[model samples]
Target: MTEEIKIQAQILTNEVCQFTVDRPILPKRSAFFSQKEDAKGSPLPEALFAIDNVVAVLISGSVVKVTKTNDEQWMPIAKQIGAAIRKQIQSGQPLVAEEDVRRSASEIDLRKKVETILNNEINPLIAQHGGVVSLIDVRGADLYLQLGGGCQGCGMADVTLRQGIEASIRRALPEVEEVLDVTDHAAGTNPFYSPTKK
Candidate 1:
């Protein structure tokens, strides 16, 4: 018989909960799924999204983060998520479809370079305003990003995206085609400078 999967569940923030499994779930490639469509090929991520209120999922090694609407409590949903993960694991199949997480050498190089700029340059400035910008994925020459913390719902998010975030990335990587924002600003709770409420 296959060993039962054990997962330690914890709340990361009002909107996010984490599940740490006993073994590596996505050993080779990490993934971030913000929409149900994004979970297509990944069985584990797809299972998590089936749970109501699950807005996002981040899979890195043994860690899986599930994000929900701020208004919903984790009390009811946590068990469902845990059950889904365990079920997928116990099914004795690959958690993620290889194609879903595979990256070309060129894509990998670009991703690392983009992350370096986000870490060394962009995030430092955004941090001052209680915000954070993260690269979600790299597809071909385009980048998918999500802004969190204060930048999530800030009135100046667009200005920051166009003038600051995109500008910096474009300057450092002219080959990068599109820098898209996939953040759910409506779910943001404590935007530092929300000129108008979300």
Candidate 2:
């Protein structure tokens, strides 16, 4: 068998950790465990494991990260999970369903709507502060945006994006699922409102 897959696990913080694999697991054929339930009378935490000993599994981009209950040891379970992932990948199963992707992609006409909103609403408001909002791309219902000028490095940018920009876009286009700002807030060299005195 070709060693096309590899798994590595590392503890990030006491509460947060990460496990990464070299190859993509879960082919389209394999079943997706999406049902989330917990025992009655007890309110379950977000990371609580409903499937046997395994807790929560999240697939973001190319990585499959898992979080387990506080009592569980990751070392022993890591190997088992890695083996299962490898088996699923080698079997040629699809990681995510095509129907879901199609459904998500169909929800919103991202480019046109985003451009319209930016042109009409966001730009006019930001222009007052010498800032600009640029639409990067739209994948499914998620929009990628970049903030420049006065808005880029401002400490209040997060607040503006969440409360102002996101709210306005969502109001204009209800089909939009999320607006993500992909700007590198730390590297803003020409922010419109710089603190340094001349």
lDDT of 2 by residue, 50-166 (tens): 334665444434455565567766677667666666665665645455543343344334666788889998899988987888876565678888998889998677877889889
Identify the leading candidate in terms of TM-score: 1
Q: Give the clashing residue pairs of candidate 1, or none.
A: none
Clashing pairs in 2: 27-93, 27-94, 28-93, 28-94, 29-94, 150-192
- Compared with the true structure, model 1 gives a TM-score of 0.70
Lowest-lDDT window of 10 residues in candidate 1? 99-108
Off by over 4 Å in 2: 1-108, 194-198
lDDT of every predicted structure (CA atoms): 0.85, 0.62
Residue 21 displacement in candidate 1 (angstroms): 0.7
